[model samples]
Target chain A: MDPISLAFGLILDPYVLTVMVLAGSFGLFMGAIPGLSATMATALLVPVTFFMEPVPALAAIVTATAMAIFAGDIPGALLRIPGTPASAAYTNEAHTMTMNGKAEMALGLSLTGAILGGLFGSAVLATSAPVLADIALRFSSFEYFWLACMGLTCAAFVSSGTAVKGFVSLLLGLFIATIGIDPMSGHPRFTFGNVDLMGGIQFIPAMIGMFAFAEVIRSVTATTPHFRPPQERIGNIFKGLGPVLMRYKVNLLRGSVIGTAVGALPGAGSDIAAWISYAVGKKFSKEPEKFGTGHPEGIVDAGSSNNAGLGGSWVPALVFGIPGDSITAIVIGVLYMKGMNPGPTVFLYQPELIYAVFLSFFLANLMLLPLGLTAIKSSKRLLLVPREILMPIILLFCIVGTFAINNTVFDVGVMLVLGLIAYLMEENGFPIAPAILGLVLGPLLEDSFITSMIKADGDLLAFFDRPIAAALGVVTILIWIVPLVVRLRRRGRLPEGVG
Target chain B: MKVNDAVPGAILIVFAAGVFQQTLGFPPMPGQDYGSRLFPQVIAGLMTLCGLSLIATGIANRHSEPLFVPAEWMRSPPHFVNFLLLVGLLIFYILVAGWLGFIPTAFIILTLLMTRLRGRGHLISTLAIAAVASLVMQQFFGQLLRVPLPWGIVPPVYW
Candidate 1:
């Protein structure tokens, strides 16, 4: 089956089409909730994918994740509360726009930006995935180990103001990752004798607990007086798409490119892609000052770029069998479980299935536009909801969602414990994002580092011998040092007696 | 409780020691070198370093305020208790899930939790919620896909 034939077949599949729209809408709904993130939605829904035909399942997951990601901006825009940490950067600006009576306009730009970026990212993925996947295929375990390390490090740093703090977070994640059966020795590293611990911490549950439950804990504590959102007298939310288009064409293009590039980087996920693009956007925007103050451009650029990141991340999975983000990582696992080995092999061997996936993604990306618009309109009511009322429901979702995965009692316990810890950590000015990243990437770094050591007879130089590995290592070091040096320079030589 | 500096420092030192001890307990691999302990030891060592750093930084920024509890959190006992109870509920649900089955356990947990949190309505909501949750999980997850749901008190029809 040729790609074109598969694509047409996917278009005609009723199940695939229905799933695309429904999942997109569901993603938007879940993303609008404070803690139920796109990643969680994707993970929880992954189990369900086992029930469907490959095309519908993949399309549903993709559509839901994409729409959910964009919908995160809605809460960020309406309530100074960001639905996902990715939207945290633009929370101030979007909320301010809402306060200033541009709620409709703010939502409009965010939706438009998300649609444009999704389209742009899909186009990039459609065109350039083959080339990038080829490059990614050249990678060995050596490259992957470093790549994962680099991702952990970057995620850690971007998540916080301090550099060492980020490193610590990555270390923590590595530590947790190492908890399960030692990939090398088959020895249980951290599980003390319980069969349940053999699998280590369930990522989805821990992620939900850490990211979602933690938010519930915070909302419970931070009793800001509930007030209704100021009514937007403006009739049209799509008030000013022209300026956004004319002014931010370059930013949008560059953001999509960056999103695609970062997304292709095996370890760098969509969240990082969005942040880096926003950094790039603000750094180069002619009206940099207008950013973070409700300029539709800022919200649009960030949202669109992040959504574009979805495609970028997918490219590696489809072609090289490597996941660029946590969500895609699950998708890769699902594909394999269904007997598809994603990579050039998947494209060449299972042409029909692969093309169906590609076409499904295309429709999924397009589907986000209407779903995003509908989300914006409905979620505006979130602003009208009382915090006390809305928060409890969100909390319910988090609890139910966490328990739904694995249906394990231990997991629910883990969620509660982690959430409590997250709440305390937040209060102490210690960020939780790095911690989650640490929990995630910790074992990957350790496994690779140790495996590489064993493979190379314990020679440290072996890590740097491979050019790609060396380059990634150098980049990681640079990422660490540059921040340290800058901070020291600003703070006047680190107060002389530092550490 | 130790002040900020002493608290983190003391805690890290204690926890790092435990980590070290745990790492040392891994069984050695007979012929295949690089025992499981090696990885844990390495991570624990890194953790020790980080812990020490936390101690140093925490002390550097220490003030005369309370050591264990932050001022903002001191006023919110109900919320704190609420959080703890939520956690407890999850643990309870987990314990009964295998025996009660996924649908029943989830429904029960949802009802009990919502009611405990002062959610409105009474038995009607609980039974309604339980029936709905059971049917949804059955049709969607169990029937549609072979993912399998738990069956304990009442045997799962599919299973």
Candidate 2:
């Protein structure tokens, strides 16, 4: 059978369809909660997916994340709190719309925008990924080394806090990655004489620790006043949504394009895409002053952009095995575990699987229409699920999830220790996403560097010998140095206009 | 609690030094010039530099920032207890779950945490929720997924 038919066969299987629907509902629940995020939802889903075939596994994640991103807007519209960071960009605008008794329109626009933009991104992914994979098939260790470095550097730089803190978190992750046996020499590095340490720290438990468990700790410790659910009832969300979408058709297109472009960049995800799209939407609007005053225009752009970004992020992940965001970082881990080893080779070896993933994106976005509307309709009761009861249950789920991966208590211990450290790290303004990216990419970065070094026989300049490698290397180096130079110049330690 | 960057910076510096020290003992690959030590050494070196930069910035902002800032939750007794209890409960599970079994341990942990967070007034509801949740989790993960969750002291029940 051809790849398309095979993909159709895989997706249309009853089991995979069941998994997608269940995952969509799960995503909507997780995303509509204020504290839980799309990344956490993916992290929590990993162990369950571990038991499934690669097709269902990837489909579950894709469906969950796409639904999660759209569902985040529900809380933003109702309670003025973004369910996920991706919805934060237009939370004010959305909440203001709710305040003005336009809750239906606000949520309606978000759902419609998300569905359209997600489809556009999936189209771009379907078209562009194969072509990129063809280009990527030519890459060697040197080129890969530069790409890995560039990805890590971008992650550190793009994080919210000081670059130094982000870099430190990344280093911490890299150091943790080195704890097991050295892949190159078959020698132990930092095992500290423990048998379990020989295999290195497992990323699954570590992810649950950092994302889900740490979030549990934060929610329990939070002293802020709880938000009340919106009093207004939502009715006929799709009513009159057509004329509004028709009016903002151009904004929708622009947001999708911008979202796909931004999301395709390594280390930038839907959160950043949403922010950029919202700002761009405001800047280009004919009535910019009305923004944050129940304006649906910015909401349309950012809402679409965030969901579109889910599809956009998969490009680099599928083509090069380099993740575009933390969620994709988890996907990369899953890919490795499944022996798919995401890269151009996956395209060559299993084109049907790749097509199935593409098809799943389409299925997920279409599923979002009904699932998202149902969530919006039931937003009040969903939001009313007390965190007190919900959190302990989630914590139990985390423990079970972590334990299920390897069925070892040692993994559970890893979760406990790492979760605390993550909590402390975040409390001190350090970003956790870069550390995740670093952990996922550490072996890739190290292996590529070591292989390239061996090929060069200790010659440093040979790293830049290849044209593509040279360009990537130069860009990566400039990213590191230019920021330092600017900082020094700002401090009067260097002459102005030195560049 | 949040601390000055200098604190974490100094800790990182010490940690990097230890990593660098440890890497010195790794032998080179038999035929290759570079060995297992090179990658770790490079990471340690970069980490050291980052640590220093953090320390420098922390010192520069010392006057404006406190050595440590207690989070608002720390000042609230209930919130502080909630934080401690959650961490304590996780550690408790790590220690006892294997011997006491998954369902009972999960039930205890969930009930205790919920009662603490939701208050004594909701004890009965907390118990009900915890019982149902633990059973559902056992069914979902232990049975359906075949995760081999420990049965410990309890008799194993099979469908």
Candidate 3:
């Protein structure tokens, strides 16, 4: 059978369809909440996905994330709070719209934009990924080493807070990755004479710790007074959405394009894409002063962009085994566990599976229409689920999820310790995403570097011998050097008594 | 609580030094010039540089920022207790869940946390929610997913 038909067969299976619907609902719930995020939704789903076949597992994640990104806009329209960071870019604009009694229109605009932009992104993924994979198949360890470095470097730089703090978080992750046996020499590095440590830290429990459990801690410790969710009646969201789409058609297209491009960049994700798209939309708008005053222009752009980014991120993840964001970082771990290790080779070995993922993206975005509409209509009740009751339940789920990974208390211990550390790290203004990216990429980076070094026989110059490797190496080095040079130059230009 | 960057910086420096010290003992690989120690040492070296930079920044901003800032929750007795109870409950589960079993332990943890967070007025509701939640979790994770959650002294139920 053709890969397309095979993909269709896989996606159309009753089990996979059921998983997608359930996951879509789960994503909407998580994303409609203020504190929970799309990443958190994905993190929490990992344990359940652990038991499923690869197709359903990947489908569940894909469906959940896409739904979550779109659903984030719901709370942004209802309450002033964004359900996820991706919605944060336009939370004020959306809330202003709600204040103006245009709640249905605001939600309608977001929903329509998300679905359209997501489809556009899926189209690009379907057409472009295999082509990229073909080119990626030529890459060797040297090239891979540079790509991995570039990804990690981009993560550290793009993360919020000081670059130094991001680098520290990244280095912490790398150090943790080294705790098991040395893959190169078959000797233990940092196991501290423990048998469980020999296999290294499992990223699943670590992810639950960093994202879900840490969030639980944060929610419990928060001293802010409970927010009274606004009670609003949502009417026909589809009423009069067409002329608005027609009016902002150009913005929608621009946003999707920008979102895909930005999301395809390693380390940048939907949140960044949404911010950039919103800014771009505001910049080009004829009525720039009208922005943030119940304006739908920026909303149309960012709303679409964030959802479009979900598909765009998969490009690097599937083609290069380098994640484009923290979500894909988890996807890579799951891929490795499924033995369909992501990269160009996955395309060659199982094109059908890749197509299945693509199909699920389309299915998910289509499913988003009805499901998103339902969520918007029910926003009041969804937001009313008090955090006090929800949090303890989530904590229990975290414990169960962590324990199910290996059925070992040791893994649960790892979750607790790492979760505490993560809470402390975040409290001090350190970003957790880079650390996750670092942890996911650390093994790949080390392996590629070691293999390249061995092949080059200790000659540093050999790292740049290959044309592709040289180009990639130069780019990675320039990213590091350029920032420092700029900083130094700025310092030099300052007057002597400036301080 | 949040602390000055210098605190974590110094901690990282000491930790990196320990890593460097440990990596020094790794035996070199035969026939290869680089060994298992190379990657870790490089990481440790980079980490040391980052740590120094953080310390420098911390010192520069010392006057503007406090050396330590207690989170607002620390000042509120109820909020502080909530934070402590959450952490303490997790540790309690980690210590006793295996011997006491998943369901009972989950029930106790959930009930205690809910009562603290939700207050005593909803005691019956809290107990009911905790009971149903624990049972549902057991059914979902243990039976459906086959997670092998410990039964301990409780007789295992067959579906």
Deviation of model 1 at A194, angstroms: 1.6
lDDT of 2 by residue, A1-499 (tens): 8999999999999999999999999999999999999999999999999999999999999999999999999999888899999999999999899888898999999999999999999999999999999999999999999999998999888877888999998888888888899988999988889999999999999999999999999999998878887777889998889989999999999999999988988889999999999999999999999998999899989999998898999999999988999999999999999989999999999999999999999999999988988898899899999999999999998999999988888998899899999999999999998889889999999999888888898788988899999999999999999988897778795455565
For all candidates in order, the CA lDDT equals 0.68, 0.93, 0.92
Better of 1 and 3 by DockQ: 3
Ranking by lDDT: 2, 3, 1
Pairs of colliding residues, candidate 3: none
Q: Model 2, chain A: how large is the TM-score?
A: 0.98
- Compose the digit string of candidate 3's lDDT tens values, residues A183-220: 89999998889999999999999999999999998999
* Model 3 chain A worst lDDT window (10 residues): A490-499
Model 2, runs deviating above 4 Å: A493-499
Tens-digit per-residue lDDT, A371-463, candidate 1:
777667666575454444444445545555555566666776777777776665655555555566556555656666777877888678887
* Highest-TM-score candidate: 3
| Candidate 2 lDDT, B1-159, residue by residue in tens | 988888888988999999999998999888787889987898999999998988988899899878899988999999999988988888888899989999999999999999998999988999999999999999999999999998989899987
Interface RMSD of 2: 1.2
lDDT tens digits by residue: candidate 1, B1-159: 124645645665676678789888778866545678876677678777767877777767677545676545346685556566666666766677667876676666556655544445555755675567556665665566544556778766753
Candidate 3, residue B5: the lDDT equals 88
